[model samples]
Target: MAFVAELSRSVQGRVVLITGAASGIGRATAHVFAREGARVAVTDRAQEDADRVAGEIRAEGGEAVGWALDVADGQAIETVAAAVAERFGGLDILVNNAGTTRVLKIDDGRYDAAWDFLLPILLGSHQRMIRAALPHLRRSEAPRIVNIASTEALGASSPGSIYSAAKAGVTGLTRSLAVELGREGITVNCICPGPIHTGMTAAIPDDNKTIYARRRTALGRYGDPAEVAHAILNFCLPASSYVTGVTLRVDGGLMVRNA
Candidate 1:
């Protein structure tokens, strides 16, 4: 009974700042945390989308605010992080989920462009956001950082090598930061989601998605954004204090299948 009560109140009243919260996994994460009574800062590159999501949360009677944030921009990161910390009184959870995808062959003309564009947003932003939120997180009783990586980090798909590389960097960053901040009782972790139905995959044909998921994922289906969100929520719980430096695969056993 005591354990259940403590777990229930674990994340209530904590301030959570999530990047790319306008849609997909980020949007789902914002809703899940808010449902758990966490005050949420919903940020995205698109100001209107961010506003819309935040508004939806407010309509659901959750505490929230929205901001336009380009994770690739250092100034924007610092500003938004500061504003959210101030608005919510302090930051307790940081979910670095802002990201997009670009696929190009190694020899393609746009390969360099894709590299420059993807690396900063996917890999570099995590570091910058963590740095920006470090001060407030240090002040919180149970600070948690959850970086959203992808299954691409473990296995490669043609023309997505760049994306895979960046995600691999996220896992490495999670481990390094976890070790550095563990002494402070700040838990840093990573989530690697596989074949989630997000905007990035919206263009993929339905038949193709089903075939791919059946072959690659043990669950034989692409996961919903909310499924990944729930995993992120679990890591942010105060009860997860002892779990740090863990790179959890929220991908329905996608990596375990040999066939």
Candidate 2:
């Protein structure tokens, strides 16, 4: 817990809104942020899971609240943003970590599968959240947005073409928003993670995982959720105000190796 607490640079009293807070990277990030003394708003499509995360935070003596949100819906994002502002006074951080992926090759006669599965969550949801939170973020003294991406955005080409494209769009959005919001005291950045052990990755066949481990990753294992959370915490620090528009890769050197 102390180690986790040290990850954040004293964000005590800051308000953070995290999307996809039900489980996986989002849940892990929420826990890390709460431990570091941030007031967290845990949001997910599943109301029960969101409430559970909020309860765990409260039980640990952290300030937290849960909201059910369909990140793909603009109206829902707007409503949740308003609720967060009213509850926490203002927003300091927005983490666009909600996404979905479907594995389908471009040459397998299923190219559309990628777009159909990833567009709504990756592109649509991120834009909606950013739009909804912009007003409140402008009012805060320090505002940050962290967009989660994948190494595929840089041309990995394993999971699916759609996921790659969507993540690439995320990278683009991070840079664009960083420039658009820099003068307003808002910093935007993206994180590109390699193969991580999460529910989403669990769907991949064991054989494929083994192949990926053997060939791609220099660490010889999938990345832990905490590793990504650590990077997220770094982005939310006030000291990182000048670090916007950059994509930090947390892939354990996988992207550089073609094993």
Candidate 3:
């Protein structure tokens, strides 16, 4: 219990909603928040996985609930957000961590694959979630929205052009929304992680992974999901209210590499 208690600076009693809470960074973030005494609403497309994560949190004497919904669907996002607000009484934090990636070349006729996969979860669903939670967030004294973007946003060309574009859009949304919501006492920010070891990267070929390790990262390894979660918590803290409209990179110093 003491171990979990040390994971937070001031997350106690806050109500947090995190999308893509089944696995990877989202799952890790949920655990981190719950450890800090936050009431967490864990949403994922997979009901079983969501339930498992919620159960784990409950077993640890933390407050948590699981909701299953496809973030790609606007209606589903609205329903989930409303339910969270109604159940929790109010919302203090929103983490838009749901996203999909498709590796298709620009010259390929299937360039739309990335857009079709990413638009709903990455851009559309996040927008809907924020809209639905805005009313409740406005009621809170300190409200925060953290959008998970990627380092690919800084470069025009990438392994997946469409994925890069989608991430770029996420960064843009973060800045624009920060301006729009700042007056409402909500601080909006983006986290652009370079190469985190998540389910999304499990399929990366070993040779390609080695090349990435050598050429891109200064730390000589992929980042852990918890590292990124820590950065998110930093942005969500009350002390960070003035630190808005920025993208904090938690990428093991990968952005500094030219190659």
- Candidate with top lDDT is 1
Candidate 1 achieves a global lDDT of 0.94
Off by over 4 Å in 1: 1-9
Q: Which sequence of candidate numbers ranks them by TM-score, best first?
A: 1, 3, 2
* Candidate 3 Cα misplacement greater than 4 A, ranges: 1-9, 206-208
For model 1, residues 174-234, the per-residue Cα lDDT tens digits are 9999999999999999999998999999999999999999998899999999999999999
lDDT of 3 by residue, 1-259 (tens): 4553333359789999999988999999999999988899999998888899999999999999999979888888888899998999889999999887777777877777656776777788778889988988998877999999898887654567777877888899999999998888799999998888899898988778878887778987888899999899899987777889999999888888766
Worst 10 residues of 2 by lDDT: 1-10
Which candidate, 1 or 2, has the higher TM-score?
Answer: 1
Name the candidate, 2 or 3, with the larger lDDT value: 2
Question: Estimated TM-score per prediction?
Answer: 0.96, 0.91, 0.93
lDDT of 2 at 59: 98
What TM-score does candidate 1 get on C-alpha atoms? 0.96
* lDDT at position 202, candidate 2: 86
* lDDT by residue for model 2 (1-259), tens: 4553323367888899999988888998999999999999999998898999999999999999999998877788999999999999999999999888777767776667657656988887888898899888888777899999988899757657788888999999999989988888799999998888888898888888878787778887788888999899999997777789999999988877755
